[model samples]
Target: MVQKETFGEVIRKLREESGLPLRKVAAHLDIDPSTLGKIERNERTANKEMIEKFAEIFSTNSKTLLVSYLSDKVAYEIMDEDCTKDILKVAEEKIKYYKKVKKLIVMPTKTKIKPYKEIDSDVLTLAEEEAYQLRIGENPDDIDLDVIDKINVWDKSVKVEENGYYWKGEPYITKGKLPANDKPLVVELFCGCGGTSLGFELAGFEIAIGCDIHQPSINTFKTNHPNVSTVLGDVRKVNPKSFLQLLDGRQVDVLIGGVPCQGFSLNNRKRHENE
Candidate 1:
């Protein structure tokens, strides 16, 4: 069996075949002579630029050099490892999955969300409609349309979080309007005196519930949102069961809140209500 040559070996062979001295090639490649020698011995790795330069110096195919380099890397990486065949088998599947998948950009947490436009398209499927529910936060339309098409077709593969909407493991695909509602339901956290909830209610959304840490603020919230449920507790400790019971089978059409300023935290040396 003929041994497959490593990238360095192939390049070194080409250099020797051309009768080019090592230092002369190193001068052309802009690397030290020792580095070039190590590369020839395959004790150093070759970068893409160096591979292309090697091809230029030796009049060889750039692709052939690159292929040898990549193959050597893969072989060395998997060599002397347990279950090498299993590693390649799983890697092959992952490579296929990656090739078939588009890289999606995830929006940062705390990204400001724009309310979706009014729903209008007749071609919208139920799956697409449910995907629209995420618009209460981010719309998937903000991402690649081709990627969104795949996501919608693939059962919407998403996880809704307090931080943001995730597609598979990626975050914040925005598009499509919020679900149709005459008065979209609203729930508030860190609801100091229900100011934001009051604004949504005035804008035609129904204030469903509000939670605040201060008894005074909760009382004020009740005064402002007479028909809405009120929870007086740190939002972090609010009972999930009671919270859901307050929803009473109705989905939250909106979640609005304004928490204490960072200045209010004990960590802030000058923290005070004035902040």
Candidate 2:
């Protein structure tokens, strides 16, 4: 008998065939690697949004990929629905049935990597634990919104002064400031998804400008901080002089970036020939 590969097994096989590592794939989708691993192992089923992301990243047709692992009845039914929501509904139902039937077993190779739940007791309540397991590095979609609202309400009630998104009673956001009140007007550089800009605002700095290469990150920053000016392009291509021009002749508080570390690493042995 040919051993039936589970949905996760099919996904993992596809991921490997594409020559992409889990970490790279996760980063492309803004997901945690372990969470992706869990999906590949079928420890948890991915939601509609994540499933769509996987489809895009893996370059696989979502309906075709899904049908490969589903029964004929389910496969045909899903082919009819086609939309992500319907596909996810079918996947979830299949996952639920798989769980109840105990027909699915964690593959031995996958078991060696520990589950995410094993390491998170420090920050999660029982409910948050469930939520965390369902979606790593994001608010769990499976969780009831009302329950999450209650938790957020309770968390905010205790720390009313803190201004940021809270996750499981801890701040998912951080704010920072430069020492001394004499620091110059701030312009954020390579400001990823507005984290640094938001931090500057929280620290009482007037964010006059921000810049980033990624369009999505720039758009997100614009959405959150409409008052701040942002230029979207390669930091190197945008002359430092032009960046200062955005400041309208004001001094900069900070500039930050990892200058293509791979470039430095490639020259490491060449430059250190004496060693």
Best by lDDT: 1
Reference-based lDDT, residue 232, model 2: 71
> Which 10 consecutive positions of candidate 2 have the poorest summed lDDT?
166-175
lDDT agreement with native, every candidate: 0.69, 0.59
Give per-residue lDDT, candidate 2, residue 151.
48
Q: Write the per-residue lDDT of candidate 1 for residues 67-118, one digit (tens) a residue.
A: 8888898899989898989998999988875443322212234554444556
Per-residue accuracy of model 2 over 1-275 as CA lDDT, tens digit each: 44366667777987899999999988977989998899788786665566567788888888865554454335445656549576777778977855543322222233233333344476445654554445443333454767744543222235233212311231112212224445446677666577776777788777766666656666787788776667676555665666555565667766644232322453332222121
Model 1 earns a TM-score of: 0.38
Q: Top model by TM-score, which number? A: 1
Which pairs in model 2 have colliding backbones?
A: none
Off by over 4 Å in 1: 1-3, 103-275
